[model samples]
Target: MRFSVLSFLTSAAAVSAAVIPSSSSAPEKRGGSISVTPHDSYSSSIGVLGCKINTNRAAYWPSSPDCNNICVKVSANGRSVNLLKVDQSGGAHDISYDAWNYLSTGKNATEAPTAGGGLAATYEDVPMSECAHLLKDGKHLAFAAANSMNFITSCSANTWVGKNYALYNILNTQCTWGYDELCRMPDPSQGNQPICEHTLGLTVALKTCPVYNIAYPTGKLSIAV
Candidate 1:
């Protein structure tokens, strides 16, 4: 896959405390000024995961305490397969695509809005037997008969949501959405295809930034701005 070299902003500053904002606060105006909560929740330094800063509620994806880290859930045949903890600073969408590529090709992949032949992104079928090799735990045999294709198909057909949540909200103080600016996200496909080819069975609605912090050891990641 083709990877876009996106430059991210960074500061040497470190946050002291992190807290989720209460839902009762009135919604900040969409596509307006972004407010930064002065706290130590975010760090310019990279962590176990690639999380950078604490995002506000309006922010698309939440930053993990660890920089570049992402949590993923893999499911097949309507049954939960495994929860994956990985690292990718490219954002949630890119990380998701990379996970798919690893499962399908057994090779590391990069971020790209398009795939082979510039077609909608797609992955190869990988049988569950091969999971042991491609996945971290090379010896689990629970879904051995199932294939990666089933997982991919299930992701695209069952879990995928359209474009990520809007990035022009208050929590996304750093990103400039409507105008072409440094942090603006790429436009999504009109066919409801995810920025990532498929979803990873994450419970949270896909967000524009796709960055996240893990909520639990299993299931979808619970991300907060």
Candidate 2:
């Protein structure tokens, strides 16, 4: 069996709130002014989360507080909607499906028209045994198997959405659908093809572990998972 480059972020650490960077060149204040209940949240300082800002409804968790921190307010069918910032796990580069929906369906957003009706942007589970390595005590075993996550955080909504292996080398196809603007993320969401390879996110997890002093504790990982 072959592995990928992107391992897993095993080690744990004390992280502070970070923001993504926004555009330096302003959009040249246009003509008329607009109001928004659910507005598009834009900011100049964005970290860890990248340059994208959350819309009225795209954000989740502490990142969001009510109808604030939105990206853009879209105008659809005479009604308005707010675009929040939700995230995609592996693609780490693009926005989540839910966030995509919220942003496009708002009066606060750019009103990117719906499906030609007019044109709308559109946007999972697996087994437990298959995901055993990812568990510690019926939960994400970040500490048990991977031994980096410290095994405390909650698991993603569903499992088995996809699977990947870690290796020093990756195929181009692996990253065909993804796009990487930084050294961190290098693949596209749709990746290239059977020949195109990429470093999987799992690889990144393990790689970052050592930096955080989280070496894999032999017998700690499991394939039965």
Candidate 3:
């Protein structure tokens, strides 16, 4: 696998949070407001993590990745729905228009719902396996490598895989060759076939990718060819 020096630097430059291990504690049920957001090309397809999500389904953007690809059971307005965690909202739960409409009217609507404040709701994390039916075919829940800097970058997603083995091979090559270099994988959500050529700057290569152990949404999810 060929690795690009520039791509690694670009990914590293986008890094904001320090390289810390993902939390291992279980996610507890929480109450908050589920804001309604318009569905657009980006929201319907490319998420902040560069993953493709089915907006037509009960999809939502959580404030973080604690529920990434996990099934979240949300209750509001005397109605309940199971939402698939697909993107980052930076605020409280921001749900797709379809999800909000269903919660408000108890039925799916073709037109967008009337704009308003978030609906008061409570949500709890459920395993991804339970929500697998909601995801599109060829999509799967994948964990991020510990040093992947995924939280702050849009070039990669926990679940997005390169159409081919390009990105996977690049990471594997770097790991096998013991190259301590930062690298950017292709943004698959941007197009059907993309080249892995973006750049991220770094003088020294980061540590080897570690197998992250997380507790919630239990299962070993991996990025594959």
lDDT of each: 0.23, 0.22, 0.38
Residue 84 in candidate 2, Cα distance off native in Å: 5.4
Collision count for each candidate, in order: 15, 83, 15
Q: List RMSD in Å for every model shown.
A: 21.3, 19.5, 14.5
Which wins on TM-score, candidate 2 or candidate 3?
3
Backbone clashes, candidate 1: 15
Question: Model 1 — TM-score against the truth?
Answer: 0.21
**Prediction 3 global C-alpha lDDT:** 0.38
- Which predicted model would earn the best TM-score? 3
Residue by residue across 16-95, what tens digits does model 1's lDDT show? Answer: 12221222212221111111111112111211112222221111123321211112234222322222221122243122
Task: Kindly give the stretch of ten consecutive residues in candidate 3 with the minimal lDDT sum.
Answer: 211-220
lDDT (tens digit, per residue) of candidate 3 on 7-118: 3323333233323123333434445554444322112111122222243344435344442324677777888767665444434456555556567767554443344545
**TM-score, structure 3 vs. true:** 0.45
Which one wins on lDDT? 3
**Pairwise lDDT winner, candidates 1 and 2:** 1
